[model samples]
Target: MKKILSVTGALLLSASSYAADLTIYTYDSFVSEWGPGPKLEKAFEAQCQCDMVFIAVDDGVSILNRLRIEKTKTKADVILGIDDALIEVARGEELVQPHGVTVTGLKQELNWSDADFIPFDYGYFSFIYDSQKITTPPTSLKALIESDAPVIYQDPRTSTPGQGLMLWVKRVYGDQSDTAWEQLAKHTVTVTKGWWEAYSMFLKGDADYVLSYNTSPAYHVVTENKTQYKAAEFSEGHVAQIEVAAITQASKNTPLAKAFLTFLISPEAQTIIATNNWMLPVVDGLTLPAVFAELITPKRIGFTPKEVAEQRQFWVREWRSAATR
Candidate 1:
């Protein structure tokens, strides 16, 4: 009986070791020509001698919904690129497990909580304004809402940055956010389903400013090689968000998945994220792309998940009604 038990344990360990083909579900950019998907696939295969398959979906919500639909029969071993705002959905679904591996040199600010998730990089949401259209950008959220200048924003219920904007208002106005939303309602020219739509409209000269990240201009300045747009400085600071990765509970190769999470924090991956992914790396000492290293200034804000969570649904509902009118 003891020999049978020993054989059973060994077989279990062997099965786990053999199940190293990793499937990661993430957004489109992670697999795009400029993103880290190709590099990660190459590096992980080189290091682990296992297959790394990335299933690219439209956005974070679709990825989470796919996991929920799959449930116990989940297809991916890891889930990456979920920002702080959507981290709750991943957590609530019980999709993530506590990663035992430690990531080296993650920024102290990123240690926001000791949750199951690990933050890989972060950025702040601020209006990306066309400098040619508006010589003087609005310096505060109140001014943006009140300005006669045509403004475009993504719908808070559907868009990540739009959700960030809602959180920004809740953080600044607190209990009076309902009134603030009412004020913003009057100025909005259109509410898009996603950032791509809103930003495209702004770029085509339809609006003066489009709600987006401080780091967004980094992409234009560095990649596109022109500074046609810039992030507006707000007196109330900006809504900062951290993107995180996690080992999925559905992973058959838990150990390998954990190792990949560690790899994502490596200098190699963080550098790719900063230069190609258009996000600030979580690693403290890594230098950013030359243009970003010069153009972007980090904002100090009191934004927190707790405050944002409390008011997110309320803000989304209010915006929906106001937007329709």
Candidate 2:
């Protein structure tokens, strides 16, 4: 009887080990303790009855590159944290499978028809500054370029916010993007590899301003009860960044992955993502805290995926040349 009991325990252990484990590749910030990752993990695990593992990379662009390197052998069942700026590149690589979920109740401002990726949360790219430090914040990109205020930004090669700023400049200046970059380069104290590094530097008083999202101020307002930080709205209009998640083509657990994707836009998940990630929730009816409601929502500048795909390389090259000069 003792031998039988031991064998039974071993069999149970083996069965548990063989159970499906869904792996998701996401940005490092999303998985941090204060981010929505922990809460989402707990909520999903309770419903799915399966193991959920999150593998974090540097940023959204890095997530795509890593998936490309692994190709079909990628262990990522789902890729999260990709914004609209990089979605064209991801679709070009054909790294994702169609989500096939009938999405609805998205905010009227966002119109998403893509069947492959589901919108999770979104925010408008803006420059953030401490009101006390910057008594007169630049109201336009031209004003910012002309000012002597020190600024720090991320590199577009590795960061989504960096790419958004690049596109923002291009959208504002058009053929004179090079000129804009040259002026911006003058005030730029330094350019880091990702958003967190640049924002950290700004918070540490390394620079007068940092490139970040309009919703970023909400985090400080709600979490720390500090209201000095504010997003500067430029006359050129802010770039809208719609973040998305999708199941990878290489996923072994497609059903579970699909279920997770569906859950992402659900009211429960959106509430956690909006409050913790400090972004606007895609779905409606989720009650936002007072701080979020007080955040600025700027007029958006629209760009198509085709236009972004066609011009991204040229814009980056132009930006690099101007910045270096």
Candidate 3:
């Protein structure tokens, strides 16, 4: 097992350029042509006059999984995509260390005071559909799960949105989640390993609805002037995913890592992330696009980070058994 993990870890470090002052590990979408990574990297480079690099992985979960495999020899100075649900899991594994950025100017609604993780952006996990095709949408999570509408979602074993759905069903259905998963699987077109795979399939008009963020439509409106995409606000509320960054326990560049984390919550970086990443900024006051106001703001409901960490494996096994039944 150690040899396998070592090989996997070595594969990640394959053929990189010069030694970067700071190496950030993040998701693939964040560094895409349309994502915030390029702009943020350029801006930070100009500010610090240092070579900063980003190593892109499949998704948020993939970042942590890589860290777990790499263990002590990780090349990542900071990991920037673990969501709120997995904070405890990361902390318990001792993969991350405290990010010493002051949380004074953040949005008060977040109520964040963790010494470890600093939130960069957040959004609600929602099922989105083309308004032109579906006139009437599901009013609640229950309705969506029970309806025969064909759906596409990520696998809970890999994607954060998929993990959110597991929590959502558990929160709403509780003891009946096994039944709910079986029913959902009935109409589920496919479960992919990552968010983009499922979202891309939905964009091809293969499914009626796709799991995504509530702010997803804002990107369509801003980038393409297309308003057909819309998120269905569930009556039962939503599971909020606050994407965060933390300095790795193995980092020797803690100062640079801390500076990068501090910059993440700043107005300049937050603006780029909000528009490009399609998520809400963690900072309080930033003049954003008018379309952002129109996005659905569902009531937040889910387990604490500690609770999620404790029972994640159990729920995952249940989901696996039930989803495949």
Candidate 4:
């Protein structure tokens, strides 16, 4: 009994000694059971002997707002789920600090000028159409503009996917983008704030198509076990969206934060993202989800973050005139 008690005491001391902890602030879904949340926490703790304390908050904007309110006094060691639209806002607020370790291996995937943030996953924006309602899907962006079927899209000023669709027009039609928007405006039945509202409306037969990611259909086919919706193969390709993660300036623990970022890009985490999150992994060796590995593969498109950041304001201004005019 004395020996057993001594061993137990030693084990408790060992566990207590290694309780390194770090905090991460990210979008709520990121930590959800259905998302990458639980898997990442377990992986980081096991491999690095660190406790990952996830500060689950509202969407990206809410995370940013909280960061803004707290500033340098904030609790999170890292922040994830900022997109091209929100990247500028993050940059403007000076919310992030660089990781001492290089965020390498993203070179072939994304083209960004700085190293302050790193992209983990990316996808193209396309129209998700219900096959039951529309037998022949629109083949190109132009076809959607001319289609008789009513369409509903998320609002560009507010939604990330909506901004992606707006950028899609700018890249595809260039100077003719306004004219394209003018045409698309005619066919729009509703303009929603986010994918949930718009996609929910689409599912209920409110609209024929919803503006969303190319991999959006993967969830329906793989997890939901149905093919009620499919992404259109556009002639001009689709608008690309790259989601990034970075350590926060307000962090109390930088080393553990960097480790978490490394783990996120690790093969284990990437595999989870591909299968569970329905997103393309940044690392090379991670296997894609079977449905995505089979029915859907990522489509290539040409655009850069510098270009995205540069023309974003102009695109929104023009889209407003064309769409709401």
Best by lDDT: 3
The residue-by-residue lDDT of candidate 2 on 1-325, one tens digit each, is 2332343334333334435998999988899999999999998776666898999987887898899889899999999998888787888888998976667677877878888998999999999999988888989977887778899988887888988999888888889888888888888999988788888889999999899999999999899999999999888788999999998989897777777877787777889999899999997777898887788878899588788888888888998999989
- TM-score: which is higher, 1 or 2? 2
lDDT preference between candidates 1 and 4, better one: 1
Candidate 3, 1-325: lDDT as tens digits: 2332343233223312223488999989999999999999997776565688899987888888899999779999999998999999899999999876566577777888999999999999999999999999999999988999999998888888899999999999999999999999999999988898899999999999999999999999999999999999999999999999999999977777777777787778899999999999987678899999999999999999999999999999999999999
Each prediction's total of clashing residue pairs, residues at least 3 apart in sequence or on different chains, is: 0, 0, 0, 0
Instruction: Indicate which candidate wins on TM-score.
Output: 3
The TM-score ranking, best first, is 3, 2, 1, 4
**Could you tell me which 10 consecutive residues in candidate 4 have the lowest summed lDDT?**
1-10
lDDT of each: 0.73, 0.85, 0.88, 0.72
Stretches of candidate 4 exceeding 4 Å from the true structure: 1-21, 48-70, 84-89, 103-114, 295-299
For residues 1-325, write the lDDT of model 1, one tens digit per residue. 2332343334334434554688898877678887778877886576666788899765555566678789779888888866787766667678888877544456777665544777777888878887876787878888887667778887665566777777777778877777777777677788776666787788888887888778888888888888877988888777787877887888888777776776677766677778777878887667776766655565667545654556556667865665565
TM-score of each: 0.85, 0.93, 0.93, 0.81
lDDT of 2 at 187: 84
lDDT comparing candidate 3 with the true structure: 0.88
Can you write out model 4's per-residue Cα lDDT over 1-325, one digit (the tens) per residue?
2332343334333434445677877766677788877877776566666677888664554566678789999888888876765676677678898765444455375655455776778777778887877788978888888777789887766566777788778878889988888888888989886666787788888888888777888888877888777888888777677777888988776766666666566566777776766667776755565666654444566456566667777888999998877
Clashing pairs in 3: none
Residue 88 error, candidate 4, Å? 5.2
